[model samples]
Target chain A: MDVYKNLDWEAVEKLKISSGSKIVLKRDLNFLRSEENISVQFLLDGEVKGSVDCHLCLDNKDIDENSRNYLYPYFTESMNILLGRLISTDPMLSALKIKLSPPKCTIYSKTIDSRLMSELVVYSLVINDFDFDVVLNLNLTVIN
Target chain B: MKEIIPLSELRILVVDDSDFSRSMILQILSEAGCQLVTETNSAEHAMKLIREKKPHIVIADIVMPEISGIELTTKINDNFDNIYVIMISSLSQEHVVLEAISSGASDFISKPVQKNQLIESIQKIAQNISKE
Candidate 1:
């Protein structure tokens, strides 16, 4: 699968987080797309309430390489760092409830690790600041 | 620098299907002072080792072929005693959470596994095991 479909530059531009706000990034595997979708949310007082989507793509060929070993982990850890940044920059999301779901898809490959999949979603949620009661509706497929 | 106890001294087993996940956990545990950490990519091997070695703790993924973490925990509890199992996964679904706990897991840690979170959870489990 071709990983990089297209960067949503418009979404990136729409980010309105202020300076020094805390951000939390999370990633969700869209079983429909066979791709990982990243979300960046802002955090305040350990709550995520606001977020922006940060989509990442990976080539199927890369999955064949040793480099793929770092793909999921790096994506996840980087998002965590970004979340820390959002927390420092914008704390407004501390009180708002946030909800997120993976793109619609019915059939998902179960060969992938669940933690890897969750890392993808968590990475997406790391960049934006949001509140505590936000609901993250995640859609996952178990492909055998 | 935090004066935390090292994990290397504790016997740890990492169970996951992916080489990357196993390696990542191994690295993290090693850095945390785990010295006798073993890695298994399949639940079958993991269960076999649990029955034989009886490590201090088992860090296992939830979804796997042959035997899932829930089943493994159940079998371990049925056959052995005093082995701590920590279920790790990306999904925080209520059903899975309940199953892991019901299956004799000490705790469930969500993924993507944060270094601090994993360390803290392991430390807590270790402390509990020591108390027993």
Candidate 2:
């Protein structure tokens, strides 16, 4: 089945917790070609491990600098905060001493509406497992 | 036939990844009577500027890309005997605080830094430097 052909962009957009938040539901045309998968996981309040995987597609021929600059910092800071929160809450995980294995970012380009669209893939992880029940909520704030 | 001031003139270098934070610190230092203030967005740039300008005090953010404030302070202390380093950070992590002190930071201040708090920290640095 062609997942990209039936992708509900609206539903994916609705799942976004913040204006800059990236959420991926399934693999797309881009994921199949790159042979890579992006995932971000956060453990909240000593339990409740949650993760998201992202797959992006772009034409790869024409990409712009503005889009790359805009996306890079946004993703980096959000992931840092998410990971920091997880580390702070989980004492057991802190003892296990998991550390971020440096972030990997890739850029690609695609032609959409006769214009080049740039896509970025960022993968991050946060690990924490405890017995307590917890709820996870994502919040993004504008830095001034 | 010259007037002597109670507080010596200070040349301060403020380093932070955030432009907003650097500007806030600069404004606070300026108001506190610091005559020369230099600002940099990263610790590497800050070290280069520090070597060139030879500022009396360096106020740096603890967490940054590439080199961190602690690393910067350690490098400065290794080469420069007279300069003072004050670390400013939003993080109050115990490990971070201990690392900053161990790395030769003269003091650490928590962020959302108020004008008075900044002035006090600088004053403390100035006084300590004068004693040494």
TM-score for each predicted model, relative to the true structure: 0.51, 0.51
**Model 2 over residues A45-128: C-alpha lDDT tens digits?**
212222322223322323367754544434433444434433433343333222232223334332222122223222222112
Q: Calculate DockQ per candidate and list them.
A: 0.03, 0.08
lDDT, candidate 2, B29-131, per-residue tens: 7767777788988888887898799888899887676787888999999988888888976544556567789999888886556677778777766665542
| Deviation (Å) of B90 in candidate 2 | 1.5
Off by over 4 Å in 2: A1-144, B1-8
- Report lDDT (Cα) of residue A28, candidate 2: 31
Q: Highest DockQ: which candidate? A: 2
lDDT of 1 at A75: 41
Where model 1 places Cα greater than 4 Å from the true spot, the runs are A1-144, B1-6, B130-132
Candidate 1 on B37-126: residue-level lDDT in tens?
888977789878876766888898775556777788898788788788889764454555777899999888765566788888888877
lDDT of 1 at A23: 29
**Could you give the interface RMSD of candidate 2 in angstroms?**
6.0
iRMSD of prediction 1: 10.4
Number of clashing residue pairs in every model?
Answer: 64, 4
